[model samples]
Target: MLSLCLRRRRSPQSSFATCVLPPFRPLRCETLERRHLLASVSLTPIAADDQFSTDEDSVVLGNVLTSDRLDGSVAPGLTLRVAEWNGQPVGSSPIFLPSGAILTVEEDGDFHYDPRTSADLQGLAGGESAVDTFHYTATPQFSQIYVLGDSLSDQGQLFAATAGTFPPDPPYDQGRFSNGPVWVEQAAPGLGLATTLANNFAVAGAASGTENFNESLLGTDLPGVADELDAYLDAYGPTADPQALYVIWAGTNDFFLPFSDPAPVIANAITNIVSHVGNLQARGAQHVLVMNMPDLGSTPYGLSDPVLSGQLSAISQAFNANLAATLDSSGLAITPIDVYGRLEEITDDPDAFGLTNVTEASFDGTQVVLDPSTSLFWDSVHPTQRGHELIADLVLEHLSDQGTVSIDVSGVTTVPTLDARHESGQAGELELWLSADDASINDRNGPFEYTVDWGDGEVQSVQGTAAGVSLTHSYDALPVVTPEIRVRDQDGDSSVALREVVIWGTVGSDRIRIRPDAGGVHVLTLNGETVASLDPTNVDRVVAFGLEGDDFLSAAGSEIAVEFDGGDGRDVVLGSRADDRLIGGLGSRLLELRGDADLIGSVAASRLR
Candidate 1:
């Protein structure tokens, strides 16, 4: 949410302009000179914004032109021009900007600019002051993310070693312990790296040292964090890739080792972790991120016993304190992430993070929650995909703060540009245009493949070699839905885009139902077929119309507000616990409210009982 504003020059010949830099703790301003036309402009020490910012990891460009002209001249033959953009040359007018940003020169010598698809701007006439905005999304600076830890950061080393008999895929996505992509995989694309950029070595149930508790307890041979690091050094040698981001997040299992006294166990765990960090630093690893332990006392495993919970809580705090102090004194380029503090915040106010359950695991031995996204923990230990996403956000924020990575307004080379539109004359069909720019487009980066998550449990993928491709999908359900589209190249680099579309019901009798959870609201047919699903983060309310015949409309366990309309014939309407609006358009109607829900509706030809 921090922005850099380059105000217009005061005079026609003035070479310098006052640049209002981001209020990064101690606010200050810098003078930037337009030494030459189309020169690249660079800003240093950009800070990350607070939680209230839209994109927590990005730096934005606000109102590049605050006055009628950037050159500050109104005389004939003089016009507004862009000197530079984030250290990249603003080549020429009418040129395509990075990440789908647009810049157009109007007929009346005016300039219209749009930073990205997410930003909206109006054309400003020559000599007329206007604000133009755009966002600077980060690009990957590290070669790869080298991981070493336990199940929290594991991406299937244990599963592969166990021959896929552990942590079953039905609930654990691919090899991850969570129900979906882990934090590292989710963070990859945002950093302009492919999911494969995460060369994971973390093993499930790994302790900080060479000994794993799972090996002793379950008779399995899983390598610990120290062993994982050793394996990396054996493969790549002692001179580790300095360009890579090395991450070490372990020690939870060490606390679980059968020990009557927790003091020595906690001490050993911290010592082992700190020692391993030192090993990586000694091996030429420059960029390292170490995540501290979360409050083990708050986990379902710890909560089972009140005495154990209190003991584990104290142990976690002690371990974190020791690890932090050790890393600080070591004077290495190691960044300590406070996973304990963030986890505490989420558990303290679950609703703020769109989580309804934090006290218990979503997946018990028998079943999972109605929506795992609404839960923090997937099991007694690992977090759900949504929980991992929050962790990724935290990691990215810290990286941005430390200047290890930044928003490169230059362009996104691996991420594809996406455009979506409704197919002409096709009410239920949508067309998507996908394209990407890879440095090695003529070599290994091409034949691009596209994956579409229809948001209704239906996923489809298509591959092509063209610069741009148009793919179409049809929907059968009514109401609004947001579909996520991802494009990946042969090199494993990828980008994601999302778009919303509204589907309509048929003339025949339709049974419409809305079920909302932490992820979003799901619209379903009477036969339990999903019509559409909306993400609550991107959408606010859902509106549906049951047009004609005897219709049934309901908002059953919805956490989001909904508006339903029974267009014609006899209708049966049900409201959820959330405040909902219902309209009985024609014929006789029956309206029912669930729980203590407030209802707004027209009573004409309607019976409310």
Candidate 2:
């Protein structure tokens, strides 16, 4: 466990009354749409003023106001009259609540890149708020959740990719599944703990032997992990060394690259990472979870070349085995997940694993070609929004047991599989298969909730416990249509388990439905195809519609964004504040951010609070 403390270094300075409003917005944009949207939103840095007191207790100028007066509830849009310090950038931003005495002045430093700092402004009564500027020392809790690795540690990249907003030459590139309800966040609350994270450090294309990545991945060099830790500690003092430190799904990139054996090479690098992590004990991090590399050979990237793929798989396995042995011997109490095994099931029999078709999901041979409304990939190795959710669910399951703090994460899916066929060019039928490992299947209540969104306007739903190990469903589709299936557990964790079962071959009919009998089990036919025989309490919502031109809409209005499992291939309007509604979706939204804006939609979309 790491111990952190921050000494009060800055003398509080209250400059000329600079009215700080709600809070300043963050500079990072995970989505191109958001980047464009934000581009339209003007930003003006408030200049500083220097005529105020520096007393540690006195209210400062430029400080953010989060009290009742400017707490976002201010209808008709709120405004603030902010003044600057006479001539300095070191003053705070203060606010005047309706109570008269200058309300607390908040330093943006405390809420760095988060929306919570401005939560108090969302529902504030419409009125004028005043603020002063000053600097407040930041003090973090004693716990943190560190996601350390090379560029893979960067959550921004995952966010950008999932949002289809990858920046050119991004400095924040943490492969797919790094953003949103990643394993670290999912596990924190469940374990009755709070975690501060250090995201994807495993840079894309950067491996263990790479000069820039090897040690830098752990922040161990000249401006290395040590310095980074120092900076983080200064900002967030006395916080838990992240509830858990997630080491990369590394090794694959290390071995997959043009390296031979790559075991000892990778193992040595890994040893360095472990050593760095072990040193964190002095800084406070205790629990650590290491994810073994997935079977790259089964992946679209690895499969590109049969020969290369086979070689890589062998090396990957050997490396993982060695790594596991090392971890076991270290007695570091690390939880090593068979990530490769989980992915193997999905890649091997996608039709049986509850996963979207890798072929359909890919784009341009190299990338997982996405159809925006149907496809789930933007490139060869990365995942679309839906892909990220699938991976997130697997990781979160492990996290939930850690017990940081409990959150609703029941609707997610594990390994999903899909099957579809077209009888004629006019219409077709579809079937879906999903894995049932560690599922909360119970005969008493129900195990899962299933929803079907047929491209057009047809929808179907059911709820029940699993009688067997797999869940299945069938759908009839028109010539140009895509179907999406969404499943959720009792805990609210949900996933758009499958997407776009293109039925081009044939089908006798355009529509059909199978209702479960009194016993809760039934085999159904849609357009002459026997699909699902759900046990009564397993379905939730089902709909049918034309898929080709359907767009998904998204609804907003909450602290966190709503999670939309159904991926692209439909129109989505994530609605306005009150009556917001999300339309077409191929899969659940992996991440959503409404920084300073007041959200009025679903909360599932938000990966962070």
Candidate 3:
């Protein structure tokens, strides 16, 4: 993965592919109104820690056949290839280069977009990597595919689309359902799709779209998969093409409650699936791929419990059965991707798919990996990269017979995707970081004139220069909102970057990030007024900032390494949780160091010691 970051490289003619918006984070918004998507802060370039830095290549930064991030439009027939920041090739796939900038994912999964060195689209424009072309009998298969489901279907899209807000960052990092690219990603090229992502609405922990009004808070944070579908339609509407495939895979979470009766769970899950599919069908989705649940009886999690395994298996079967039946009955043009049967087949004969283990989790989150090709499963529930390939092959075969369109993806140059940083605070502040290729950064081509629907009834039109812009806003009263940001350059080009923070937050409460102004000293504010001066040394941005009182609000920047600091209240601090240096603070404190490998500081040690 590229380790590039989004910072201004001082150059007289620097043509970057990213820009930043104003200071804003999470918290309240009003109705679903449109506003310019912008959030950015200039950070000083830091020296690499030697491990990541390598022999660099002269990758030119220019506008190389960029595509529309919103409409998903670019000349279809082109070769695509992307290399890591170190200039090592990831392998050739039939991807349409989307953005002009190259990005690198940090160890902590944070991203840096270096527009200085492009992904080298123009350099490789004449490469001989030919797209594997396929002849289809039906109309053009989906050029733009919209996916809605759970981790099983999620690619790095949730992170890219939602601006790394959803799934938080630490634990559920980098949107892919598996350790690497999921099945949907693996199948993109063969289906005539440029990138594996076309509006991947799938999020980790996504449910089967059967929450009540309060439960499926469409206007609020995350509700469920059905609500996800709703939001996608409301925001993006239907794909211009009728044959666009709307893929839905879910129901793993439905079986989460092992002790509860699994009957209603399965039934409700299928019902939600049916309702969501109907919504898609109504929205002109002609080709729909409905994947049933993989066999719960076979998973490592399921096999962990003998009796409970059987119960979960039964529920999974019932859910799949109902899914198949509903698709059959509703007469929707939905093809069932038999994930359950295919997964069981691989599990039964791991050698057939070149898989080794199917009954256990492999590779700890923050460590090196075991052989993924031979491992049928990445963790207990998700599949490995190889497993995703098998699923993709199965889906392709099904689509070949049932649907239409496959592309010659070789030599197709996939452009870069946009990046943003949006954070909300306790004092009704919205912090955002919006950027795209500097060449395309204008009122015509991006972060220039875009829509930021604050999920409330309010939408604003904000402006910024071509170099990049930043703006901040404070909500008077905390209002329930999911600030949906969509930035479009002059050409209506979208780097396919759109994000709506899915985490719930207090009106103005936020975990402040301490990025000292140049010399590491800045006066902090509550709401918009100055509250205190933050002057600290040796502060790291790795540790997360926690919120204080209702009135104590802090934006993401100008904060510190202290995860929890009760500045002036009767506060309870939890130590030994994350890896952070401890320091004692004001008010009555309760330091709970529940985890090990932690150092307790002075009187701060009084509570835990």
Candidate 4:
């Protein structure tokens, strides 16, 4: 069996010489925050200098974090604690420092911080871990696959009592739909294949390169699908590997939630996944195949949307056309099933395919209706067990003992990691390390790029190669905001990590101003809040906060200044914007509101002075 292979190019910018010298075990310089239980529940004062230690089963719980080795020197007397709330664990309280910030964590287990979720806990473990060191390295010998669109792909559910495993339901029952034979099972024996040809990755209402009906209505369980795929692939071989036969019978939902930009969205997602598969191939298994779109117009969902029926058909045509072109461009050789044509034939005459009474096998003029004993679809969407088998058979027939397939991915650059600070003033920076398992890294092209929003509208960016690098950001104390960080790979693909920062100051009293001009704008900041902004809408009497503290000031068409009451008690001058003066009598009646903005002084009279 000859196989075609295309080794993509590697960027030259990251042309680093491989060096081998010492056996240095990786040390955890930054420990992740972990959740802990409280041994004793109480609202007592736990002083910083105080030490309250407990065992694993103790009622009073605390998260103890040890300082990492800094320049080979460990910080001393650094035991920290994160208290538990109720029965669960909340994040640690701020660990105030004289110079910088420090965080608390659990010392015993593996913890990873997800900038996305904001809370730190046990990171993905076991087979779920993203580490790719244990994959096989032998190239695959086959590429044939059986494509099943959705649950109705197999009609085994029709014989639910006969088949002990398959279930009978509106979505899973093959009895209601006509396409009921296990085509792959029948074809595999004739094809001389060593493994099963069918792959039922299709869930009810699934779409191509996107989520299914259930996943969207519910939610894509984090790391669930990817994690399961990883584990399954870890134990699977290309001879019968699901990867080899990329069967996707989805996109019934795309009609409902069609992509505003379908081509690129679908293309990019496929490329991302296929590139990963190539990475898998580089690790060993070969042979790859993918399925194409089915005829939803024949299904209940397609028929339901009368106005959208034509539109859905057009979208499906366009999507498949682009998909074929994209795969062709990528040098990936996949035999697409003429699902639309087949479905059209089936709908025109269900009897030809052994299906019966599918004329009403449509819903709302858009979705497909299912008829057991003949049709492949289960509902307005999805496939039956027998449908799955037919898809499998088609894939099996394509794998004749011949031809080489090559996929070139050298033009793509690989980014390895990302690092970011939690918030402007918050503790701990996030470091994300991304790796292209089998691809070469390009320093110039970069591992990726990162953009940080420190919750105060401050933005910062860094190239992917800038991993392990640190940058500082600022945040406001009031109007508590969420800190969001985004990382974009060289391919312009991006993911976000979100966190929240607690500001130490208030808003109303902190008088800051942002002056607007024809071109330029003046900004005033107090703590981390921009209490007021200047624009053409409100052209006069702008009230704002100070740059760094709680103080109020008003600006008109003149230079900005602060107001003070004369003949009153001595007013405490916190700070100033410019070289301004302040004078008042000795302590008589001077009051400053805390977290409040209330002024009793005459502004016009004091301004004249």
Candidate 5:
């Protein structure tokens, strides 16, 4: 068979050099600093005696962060991720820093700083170790994504944007409506936009307001959908750009509880939505997305009055119908995410979505203290971070259908290893592993998908796993084979890796040999299925990936030499009786020594930092 291949560029800039490298395990820095107002500050490496200013809100720092490296030499300039919480991203701005430098600024919840790459993220929060990283980049498929709506759209930046009277919910530093990064936050990186550019102008408890104003005249004066547009315009003026997708998700409050609004009020609300879209379209917003509200009558508040809940559900359906009618008739580019259908999917069969307690609100005393990771609804209304992630997955599906996504195979860490020349007419064991143990996308505790190309006409797709999964394929009388593998998460973000193999009807002398380098790798799971997997092999040359679980890995084969990267959490890794190398992750670790020559990455090693 003839080998055919296609390659997508990582960036317009840079050279192409592929080598044996470590897996790309992007970091998930959980910034659970609830109650922080606003503090997007600077990065300045403090003196050895004072790494921090002791101030929680804001700090004074310089642009050029000067600090001594572990090598006793001054560090050089480094590239850092720039992010904003409460606005629309206007352009594809790239920051170029000089080589040979790394920057780190002390930060916590309610703070703002250029997010660091996962490789360089480390800090402390609430006396416990905390970390975060930026994993998204603008690719050819799409540049940026702008959001408009209510709490769901607002990824906590609204609190700091408005400086609302209420302190932000605990553990949510960025003013997100949920406990952690919302669906947009998790989805943006996969869609090729930086996680920081998950810019939003949505406010909590927002609704489709009257014709003139954003907030309902009869209800609280929350920022209206139109008002959200005004905020965007006020910040970045007006422009019509097709590089980014415009997302609008609102209208739950329009038909929410205390559902005693008159007919005229409802009619005006629909008009308000139309006007909002018209303003955006007039400003050159090319791709517009509108998500219909779910069954609000089923919320905690709605449940209090079941009769009203039913009415609210009916009204929500009608509101969604009216909103769709206007968008379809207006003749502008428009798409709708079936949020109404999705919520039903989650509640109708909670087990499928890993959701429990959908009917009742996650309540504890008067406080709305939800883990958000699991609970669907934090309280009466807002979804948990997990809930938001599910919504983002729906959005990602839409992006995928539009063919506007750049896949990052590294995010899933699915690497396939096989000998260069395989005997034709024979089934060769082509081993594949997906190890995204350290890959922490904002809110998703992922279960990703792995699509494998066996260099022939055969293609296979499998769900990722916690401990990892292996795939093998056989070729019969094949001429040449080139294997390519790629991974996609529920949110549709992807990374790709490729390798070529020669198929001979005879035998070969030796196989391929590659050493792992400084690349990130991790595992992402979905619905308890292994989208990202790890394998512990007792082979002569071993490449074992340790994700975020208790793993008992030991190399026992003769002449065993292993390279192991242990992920977060307590782990027990036993080296070969011959010789081995082990790298521990952000967790308590214990190693069993059987090798006379063993290498371990520890606290003193700059490589771990």
Candidate 6:
């Protein structure tokens, strides 16, 4: 078998080198030198009869020829017939080969071999050579992540640019505005990439367009997202790595800057951001993640003044709506992260997410909070480390949902492990701790997919890269339930963990009231104790059971349907205005009808009031 190899040039400016492989005979390792090195090489075996044809078996040579370097020159014994062979392949153009393979050469001389039908090679018979000429094209693998944003994503660029004067290291971790590593840094590991794999071009207070607001405030001009893109293009050339991930998160600072009319300000911000995405797509960026702005009005800075808070909130909503619509219409492979929704969720119910203070900043510019772990914001405008973790969680979950990143548990002897603990002080909420022993073997920090079966015919799906996640479910009827949790990696390999939990209910006689609101159904005792709150949008139905008591159940003026079971008692039940179900168990019961309701058990066993 003979092989044809293409190697990248040593010089960054140089293109590609084509090499000829010797026949299936052993050659001394020293005989092959750096000039014949190959990277990302693909080899297809030809017939021993000297005819180039496809075989059932082919050897893939990935990083096998790493020791040798290649100068931009073709070796002897091969006639390369590519279009404009002066050197570099022109922007991933396809070059058809006679051996049923489509060779695509990227601008950087990376080779991609796509095998077509083996029947195409049948034409070359009776010792005829495979091809008179050959063309080549290939795509490069995703190498690194490129980030362009404001202080939310800035690593050390602003600190270095400012000579470490602003955001002192004591309160701020290194150069970040936050108390610790930002979202991007926290997310890198989950992506199976090191922090260095992310090339961060973000700076502090960068607007969507060409201006840096923070730099201007400091009486100097620094790079914004636009300038950052230009600098990246200058360094890496116009043809970017098509497989790499590019993140663009801006527009927060745009809202912060003074503007007479928010309409034009929002329009300009979306326009600039869309323009940046277009530029990236034109330069061969295939995977791009754009994060929308969070609620600026809810920040401590905005909360200081009610009017300003309302204005900022409105502007943020308008900007996000427009940005989403614009990106959708543009028809690019762009994934928009809902930073606004995620932050709002954390703020609305802080306890559900292990957060205590969402409205106050941990750092007041002069003093730091006693425990910054539970606080959402470091300063008035920037998120603390805990907030950053949640943001990272949102990003990882989005990426996993889009199939950009996944957990890999294949080739592991030990399966993934999961542990569930009840979240303290929160009813119907459980904290799941998941980890795979195989995670570190290959540096695989996973975006693992978690499926939680609450064992009451209700299941929930959550995604995370870290070890801990929180999930909630309400059980109105059952006294106990066994919940099962499954953590699956990208390869579909999974591990299941189960825990039995006693639900919130009383065995004694109790007064139960079921009510439905716009959000969902609420189950409570007559004493105002919450039995369960079920969101119909998330769950299928709302159910409640009256246990051991001659319970008086009422579902008056309810807009949604509910189910109630009177257990071992002469119970009095009031039906809802909507479709409802009532069950009488083991005792005489009183059934009250309001709307079209279904009655269960023997009607003779129940008495009408």
Sorted by lDDT, highest first, which candidate order results? Answer: 6, 1, 3, 5, 2, 4
RMSD of each: 33.7, 35.6, 36.4, 33.0, 31.8, 34.4
lDDT tens string, model 2, 1-609? 111111111111100111112332221212211111110111112222222222211223323322112211111222222222111222344333322223332223211111112323221222323232232211111133555443333444323433433322221123333223334444344223443434334333344433432232223332233334444556556553443343434544444232223445556656754565455555555445566665545545556666645644655565566666556566554545566666665666665534556533344433323452233333444444444445555654433211011111111222222222211122244444432222322211336566767657777666644331233334453433445666554444465455442322221113323344456553333445655454423332222322333333222432212222222332233322221112233322332333332222233333222
- What TM-score, to 2 decimals, does candidate 5 have? 0.41
Candidate 3 residue 122 Cα shift, in angstroms, is 38
Clashes of each: 1, 205, 85, 95, 41, 10
Clashes counted in candidate 4 amount to: 95
Tens-digit lDDT track of model 6 for 18-124: 34445433212221121112111111111111112322122111111122222222222211111121123344355555444445543332344433222333222
Model 4 spans > 4 angstroms off = 1-171, 174-212, 216-229, 236-264, 348-351, 356-359, 362-371, 384-393, 396-609
Deviation in Å, model 4, residue 46 alpha carbon: 80
Residues 107-187 of candidate 1: C-alpha lDDT, one tens digit per residue: 222334433332211111112222323322232255667888888887777778777756667766776788888888776
Evaluate model 4: give its lDDT.
Answer: 0.35
Error of 6 at 386 (Å): 0.9
Report the alpha-carbon TM-score of model 4 versus the true structure: 0.33
- Show where candidate 5 strays beyond 4 Å: 1-140, 161-167, 171-173, 195-198, 210-222, 256-259, 365-371, 401-609
lDDT of each: 0.59, 0.37, 0.47, 0.35, 0.47, 0.59
Which portions of model 6 miss their true places by more than 4 Å? 1-142, 196-198, 401-609
Model 1: lDDT of residue 463: 86
Model 5 lDDT tens row, 260-368: 2324444667677667767887886655666766776676656766565664565566556555665556664565677877887898888788876776555442564
| Superior candidate under lDDT, 2 versus 6 | 6
